[model samples]
Target: MAKTIHIALVGNPNSGKSSLFNVLTGLNQKVGNFPGVTVDKKVGSCQLADGLNATIIDLPGTYSLYPRREDEWVAYRVLMQQDKEVVEPEMVVLIADASNLKRNLLFASQIIDLKIPVVVGLTMMDIARHKGIQIDVAELERELGVPVIPINPRKNKGIQPLKKAIEQTALELYKAPVRDFINNEALAPAAIGSVKELFPELSDYKAIHYLINHESFALHGHLQEKIESIEQVNNFNHTKTQAEEILQRYQRIGSILKQSVSEPSPLKKTLFTEKLDNIFLHRRWGYIILLAVLFLLFQSVFWLAEYPMNIIDWGFGEISSWLGNVLPSGWFADLLINGIWAGLGGILVFIPQIMILFGLVTILEDTGYMARISFLTDKLMRKVGLNGKSVMPMISGFACAVPAIMSARNIENKKERLLTILVTPLMSCSARLPVYTILIGLVIPKTMFAGFLGLQGLVMMGLYLLGPIMSMFVSYIARFFINIKEKSFFILELPVYRAPRWKNVLITMVNKAKIFVFDAGKVIMVISLILWALSTYGPKEKMRSVAARYEQQIKQHPEQEAELNRLKNTELLQNSYAGLLGRSIEPVIQPLGYDWKIGIALITSFAAREVFVGTMATLYSVEGGDDADENTLMEKMNAAVRPDGTKVYSLATGISLMIFYAFAMQCMSTLAIVKRETRTWKWALIQLVYMTGLAYIMSLIAYQLLK
Candidate 1:
């Protein structure tokens, strides 16, 4: 066992920080929330040039030390050790975008002055060269008094050199600057000198920060009192001092970049990104392009998943049939075949869709197009009592509302932020994918539309559409009811488009699929097994009476054996515990065109909406027995018959169900996350009440009109 060198990688957004991380850690990274915060903290292990293990923490990207958003604060806290839990960084890797050296150096300069050992990993040198910009790495290094390594993580160049620099810096082979870009003593002499007495080890730069954010630092009694007294005596002004500090840093950085870098004359060329954004960012056409992109995304989920989904469905069916034939016919065999395999298969079949959806999303993100979506949607968001920042969480809700709600912490406006959290779940998350895909396939026609589009795919697009439309409508109404007057703003950066990294895309696809299969699979399996038990056994006397009644009927009317068996299964199901509960609640949901089968699903899906398909698979398998092997879940659901002999999956019933799931607060994980983020059950309960009520009303109206 050996100690690992702790390193923090800090950079501006779009500085190729994440690309470098991916290259360093590959699939070795683990993502978790920072202690007591919802923002993600990504950690990974990589071997240094000296063959020693090192831990790399990729901090949230930020432009400066002052933080307006929660993510920015996370980086600030770790760098400042504002929390007791954060591991102290032995070395800081400042990733500078070579293409944007001037602005990048502003943050780079800030870190060097923090008195920590630093190694500057200069990235995008080729991009800078392509733009007719040249950087004198030696000059920049000499000016900043830190080791500068030119690296391209994408091309796997200079990584060894960067690692070597980190190792040397950690070993004190490279010395940090004794004096940084700005003279802190000249700016705040009294406060800096006084803070140094309280903490002898404090650098002039560290003392300045202590003066500015001393309230956040771990200080007690006389130490804190002395710092406050110094600030008061010197008339320290935070806003004025920060502005002065930034101006001074930039002034010195500007002079250094002036001699060290060269750029082409302005009249010679324009960036290719600007040329592309011209059309993609057009006021009128931008909206149209965004709509088409979303249309293709939802359509692709169904269009691309069909082949793999069919394969998975067939594969699971074969396994279940083989087990049934090989194992003796009994409760254990029945449980393995119908209970476990059926539920697990129903959930697994949708993994293809989940992977494809997430893969495309990751591509959009890596290529820097996702930011454009948020930028384009800002106007529409504001009209709904939110700013463009809300679009990030809203789009994230398409994957899952729990993370989406957590992301809303970046929203500075309390009213808009809360509104975003409350309405985020209305976006059709992938959990609802199984429910939507199955229902749409069962009820919607399989015809082609306009020569290429499938009707079922179009129906899925429609299901996704309901999420944003209803979210806007809800946000509009909510804005009027919940009054808060905090001003909101939207400032987003659109990074230059680049080829998406296929490796990152694959990783995201695999991770999302694994999470759905392993995480959701666990819940679906336990619940399905419970459901199998409830649907299999009931009160002893009632079960005996049903068995006796069916046995006599079968013996007396041998010619009617086929029909008798169907009745026997149906009657037995009705007498079972789940059946009794479903029947009791059936009257309440009957008007929505739901039968006991759907009622049971509704109850089970409260654990998670993805469990809906699992519940159906188990129910249908328990009732069908060997028929379950020949017919897929969708086929079985489509052919389902009610007591009155009508098809259970009528178009009206399917649409009503889709509408309900589209708006319902069906995910306990989402509800729990909401509680944790909002810090009170009050808002969570309000969210639960309003969302469930809306789902019920919308479903009631849809079923009544369509049926």
Candidate 2:
């Protein structure tokens, strides 16, 4: 029987660790939460030579053994074997960026102390050569006492050898005494003495972790007596004093590099990196470029999706029409065609937009310009009480809020992370785009605003822009109240620009698009079906009586029969289950200028914003009449009159509805994710109450003022 070997890939942030993992594992990966924390655990399996297999766990990137954030803490925990459920790796593959060896070596040395089988995979060797840096691979391997393989993961080079080294090392077929920490001679005696006195059984790395103030040491109850003994020997605080000692170790590593590493020439600054950064990161031009890029992105989503959207629309219509003709014209037939089909149609029509947006984002991220954008925006973000870390998640909100909130885990500060999560949903996600597009199309004239800008497009742009403005306002206010004083710094690695790997981008695009279509599709479909049943089969006596009364009039005046049947169907719908439900809530929404039909759509739309269009389609389709066009729906909505003869869906009502969606907590998945991330219901509740209240007040003002 072949044993399953475990390998851990460790590296610093932006070291191409994830890209390497993707190359190695491909589709043989699964992402799960670390035992108890929200930190993600990515594990995959790969088949090695000789029919052997290995499970590779990609640990979160950390600069040192000392962890500052929860995700990094999970990494430390896994490596230390502090948790019973977490397994220690048989071998550790330490990935280092060749161009930035000084910073990358800091972690490499820490891993060497762990006594695990280790191999060094030097990434970004191409960039290093471009910058006139050269490494003697044989000398590096000898100096590190382990195999050092130079790799360009992006180009898929040096992968096979790296895999073979891992497999060979895991089988204990190779062993070498790696170079140990050199400059910590003064602290070694004290470190060993404390280990012997306090944690006699602990590994050297675990002892080092205790010396460096890792909290897991304290969590080990078995070490309490030893810790007390060590404390008595040293009057100094172990964590703080030892951290200073660790800094000396880093200095020693620097000395080793100075002696072993040589630069072929004075480090030459590349004009390419500098020139690109000059324009893309310019203070004034950067913002302009960002806005232009965003505008183009949105424009592409709208203009490009039209063809596919039309195809999907026509397909759904055909399916509904066919169902209507074949089914027995009863509740079941109505449910299949109008309810389920319409609801699903509303969800599926947005697939093209989602794919295009995600593909663009993936390209930006893979090319590494996203990091520069984060760096460029950091100063501005700090002024509003956020950091560079908040930008990606905030930008991600434009695509979807659930993942945006989940991405906040990268933020280390609890308060800052919470604030980011709280306000992220307020950013208009793609779900709201459908609502805004439809409403703006109806209310805003297509003519230019001030004879230069497209008014409708500008209004849509304004709605998108409103979200960040509101998020910043909320974050600023929260910052003032929260008493956090930790000094935050932004340290981002701007990777060398390279052609985006289209394969990776396409895979990401497909995954994200699939998630949206399937996850959101199921909810909309079920709701639509339920709604169809309600609309098709009401109180039988009421519908039968209404139809009979209309039939009598039709028999008396044959020419009026068509008009009378239309009236009878409308009346039946008003008395149906869905209609009764809508009527019950009419009084509450009357101030917003919505009638029973709009009320029904609003109720169904709580499941998803795009469902509103589907609800309208289903209600109209069940009437056994001609399919309503965009113009027809708008005209019917505009001409709807309340008991007092006031028009429903007027300019005031449309604007109010749009504003309502702009700030409302309309997404349940977003709420559920918030709850999962915060690990409490309190924050999610706060989001729900505040966002709903804000939406209600804003909508009320718009309706009242416009009225």
- Which model scores highest in TM-score? 2
Look at candidate 2 and tell me the lDDT of residue 607.
Answer: 60
RMSD after CA superposition, every candidate: 4.7, 4.1
The CA lDDT of each predicted structure is 0.82, 0.74
* Tens digit of per-residue lDDT, candidate 2, span 531-589: 66776678989989988898899999999876677677777778888789899988887
lDDT for 8 in candidate 1 is 93
| True-structure Cα RMSD, model 1 | 4.7
| Candidate 2 deviant stretches above 4 angstroms | 83-85, 176-179, 183-201, 211-214, 217-229, 239-241, 264-269, 303-352, 396-414, 429-461, 478-487, 511-578, 616-628, 672-682
Tell me how far the alpha carbon of residue 411 in candidate 1 is from the true structure, in angstroms, after superposition.
7.1
Cα-based TM-score, every candidate: 0.84, 0.86
How many residue pairs in model 1 have overlapping backbones?
A: 0
